[model samples]
Target: MSQALEQVVAELRNSLGTIGEIVGISESATPRFELFHAPNSICSQKVRAVLAHHNIPYRSHQLNIFEGQTYLPANVRLRLMGCIALGGGLVTEHTGSTSVSMGGCDPAVVPTLVDWETGQVLVDSKRICFYIDQTAADGAALRPAHLQNAIDAEVAFVDNMPNYQMLAGKPPGEDHRPESRRKGNGVGFAMSKVERCDHYLAQFADDADLVRGYSAKRSKELNAAQQLFTPEAMRAAYDKAEAGCNHLENKLKSGDDWVVGDNVTMADLYWGVELLRMKNMAVESFWANGAKPAVAAFVDKVESIPAIRASVIEWPGAMY
Candidate 1:
């Protein structure tokens, strides 16, 4: 092993105690949870928010998506094992790694939860959030059937709309263009070169019709985003998003602090992270720069929650 890998393993051994027995290899069937996540990914943020809300303690394996380090080669996993060993071994019985698959409709996405005990791997943030809500031990409960449905709908809506907007902004042309053409700016530029290459290969395959359709869909979404992003456009999208927020605010306005019924649920955790993004992106500005009392109060209410605060706090040099 490389020096770095050795160091990581040494660290894991120190932290985990007997758990380090599973580092190199072990027959024990203890289920451990490993989360592979990118530091700035929205979906990753959402998952982390849920984890925190549930107060579920698990080891984190940071993947530098910006650096193209999402896939775990055998060697890298070995290094991770080293870290887990140093962390004093796995503490949970349901041991396995989870990630959000950002590969678009593929089964190999991130935000996935792996149950080593059952050898089950689950993808999809909504599903993962629900699982955590149902299984977590000493944390807040996700209850009230109606409230869960509302929260799920809101999360799904918020999640899908941004992708549509992002897709809408691409340059128009044949889908078989060079990688440079496909990767324009913003999130695309920041994506690891490996991810960009994979995206090009996956999305711009031999099928012209498929490529065209994908591009067209993206163009529509980008156009919508453009129209919705301007000072005037911002107002429209903000109004829509705020309606979602207002749904939560109204709930909170009834003297309850959380977005869902009363206590913080997966819904609040999911929305809290998104709102943090919006606040940072100045999305609320379209609706009076968040100066409006209702919006400010709403932001204040979510931000005040301890779990939300921990999950969405600004990282150093995060604003680019």
Candidate 2:
């Protein structure tokens, strides 16, 4: 293992305690698959289930996002230092450093999969899950041939649910500002207290200017959320999650154990992960109260599979 990976494993053990040898455990010398993910991430859960179902082993890198570990210089590099000249004889300059002492992975999202054999690095969960299933030579097949497009469409619908935006800040909406500011603006006023304290700020303690700038940037997001994320929006988010559950309930009413067909498929994996998020968020009553009887039974049936069971991880922020 690299020294950097060793440090991450140590840090995770220190904070999470007895989580077992998770990060840094290599399944092979030249691992074809290496995954960096947070256990609680819904995307991560889906990817894990796909891997488990195929019995594909991977080297794991655990990232705790709430701590800002995902943004750590050791994990994600920021190339912010530059000089820009305005048309009106004005020059904006950065002093001293070429960059903020750069290092870390790019596209710093959780559940990043590095496939050494193919030299491909995948970021999106749906893409990764599809890739794995497609490449698998032998395994429980996850996609029914004719239903692929429908499954992909259903997955996208669940993915766009407003509750997901609520979990972070808010769902994306059109804004004239920069992307971060746009995200902040759409976010509701309420904030989920982070599972871990912000450690990213500490890395810049020696640079007062950087600290101030970063803090101000985050403050703008909070302010925007307060203005945009209102009570009506929050209720709408809840309703959206309920709607996702209702969709699943309707699918299950067909009396099949799976979401799309007789066998497990991408649609089942997609909804399985989404429902897991609902369970973690404490709003599963949307399922319990609104969904039909078959919905719960379907969940019970899917989660009972050895692959799915092995894929389950404890969410640090789960309400229950």
Per candidate, the number of residue pairs that clash is: 38, 2
What are the TM-scores, per candidate, against the unseen true structure? Answer: 0.57, 0.65
Task: Tell me how far candidate 1 lies from the true structure as C-alpha RMSD in angstroms.
Answer: 12.1
- Model 2 lDDT per residue over 210-263, tens place: 444344334434443554356565556666667777787888887665777777
| Residue range with the least summed lDDT across 10 consecutive positions in model 1 | 91-100
Point to the candidate with the largest TM-score.
2
Residue 165 in candidate 1, Cα distance off native in Å: 4.6
Q: What is the Cα-based TM-score of model 2?
A: 0.65
* Superposed Cα deviation of residue 77, candidate 2 (Å): 4.2
Task: Score each candidate by Cα lDDT.
Answer: 0.47, 0.54
lDDT of 1 by residue, 1-320 (tens): 25554453344334333232121122444434445445566666677677666666555545554444433232133333332333332211100112112222221124444444443444456665677677767545664466767677656655643422222223222322234334543333323322443464475578453343333324432333334334443334435555766655555566655555666666666666666666655455523554455546666667877666655574332222
